[model samples]
Target: MEKPPSYGDSNELEQPGDDRALPPATLYVAGRFVHSDDPQAPPLYELSHSVGFLSDNDRVVRLERLDYTVRQYQGTPQVSTRARHVYDLTHPTLATSPTFAYHAEATSRRSLCSFGMESFRARTLSSAKGYRVHRAARGPDHRLVGREELFTAVPARDEAVVFEWYDARGGLLARETDNGELLSLLVSAEMGPRERDALVAAWILRVWWEMARDKGLGRWDDGAECP
Candidate 1:
């Protein structure tokens, strides 16, 4: 397997590849779920249960059963679809088993009509490493994008855990940290809008998977709320 990105003095941040300035942007939790009012931060994305919202309170994504739909909040209505994902759970079959065998198509629109379809999958390797991620996007042919992994970081009494996604070449794409009280995300400034959307979609899928395992929810019919 390919190795993950290298971290440096800035905690788990990727070491700079060039001298170009990279602006500091941190989205701090400020609302019911994950929200940010900081001007420098990216759009305020909020999530709770099966629905999600942008800073403008526009419904951006909704999840149900095995599928989820994502709408572009700032695009033309004629083709505002941002992403569409359908999750499949396998392995041990029963929700009671903590085994992980799941996959989903987490695709993001490249334009108003075209999409960079990504195949996302997750499986458990051991108790120490909770889950492993593999995602690839297809243009004319399928190509490897990257994966998400956990790294050691400064721990806080209230902080839950930290997860980071890196591109195939070891560039940091995004990092998510959740505390019992709030959530935060540190995204790479170089990331494009479409790619960023797809990254967020991946997180949403992972979050739902985690919730299912935690609550022993065998089916979406259980309607488990976000915690």
Candidate 2:
């Protein structure tokens, strides 16, 4: 595996080699679900479920599904699909489990505010690290929410990655090392998720990338994107 790019350099981003890219996968769909043709129409929660597929080369690799629902505020139903639970096609044992899940609930009586506030929790199932969960309470905007320790197999005597998430921020920050050598200074905060589905996907991909490296299935290359 090539050394991960220096995080200090703003131009360097972690990317995969062209020859060893993520199995040549293709996404099938990319859009939101809605109930009506009107621009202001809300999604029919009962019939609206986001679905997509990831295929490698020509073979299907996995299926993605997201169940959505409208959130209520002060007796008014919000058109925004604020609650989402994501699931990936997997073995029978894991079929019932969600690859990633996120849900936001109202915290205050003020519902029409431009920047409404709510508490959220996200969790993911990792093949390498079992299950990981993160929680954040209602707080000031841009405040530090929490930190996560990510274990990696980089042939280090004792090395691991630290990930930090912030409220109101759209990305995650990561610090990594290899064999006691500083492999990454600080991963791009800009790489974090911009939406609910993206937030879950980013975390899952981060874990899978390390797991692939540890298992010798792939090497961590600075030229490759995370998972």
The TM-score, computed over Cα atoms with residue i paired to residue i, of candidate 1 is 0.42
Q: Rate the local accuracy (lDDT) of all candidates.
A: 0.36, 0.27
Model 1: which residue pairs collide?
A: none
Q: Among these predicted structures, which one has the highest lDDT?
A: 1
Q: RMSD in angstroms, all models?
A: 13.5, 21.1
Model 2: lowest-lDDT 10 consecutive positions: 108-117
Over 4 Å off, model 2: 1-63, 68-162, 166-194, 216-227
The most accurate candidate by TM-score is 1
| Tens digits of per-residue lDDT for model 1, 1-227 | 43332212114222232223434345444422333335543333433343211221222233211112345666843322222221211222334332223333332222111112222332245243223445432323242343443211122223444766665455666566765434455765565333444454455545444544455322322222223
TM-score of candidate 2 on Cα atoms, chains taken together: 0.20
Output the lDDT of residue 216, model 1.
35
The C-alpha local distance difference test score for the whole of candidate 1 amounts to: 0.36
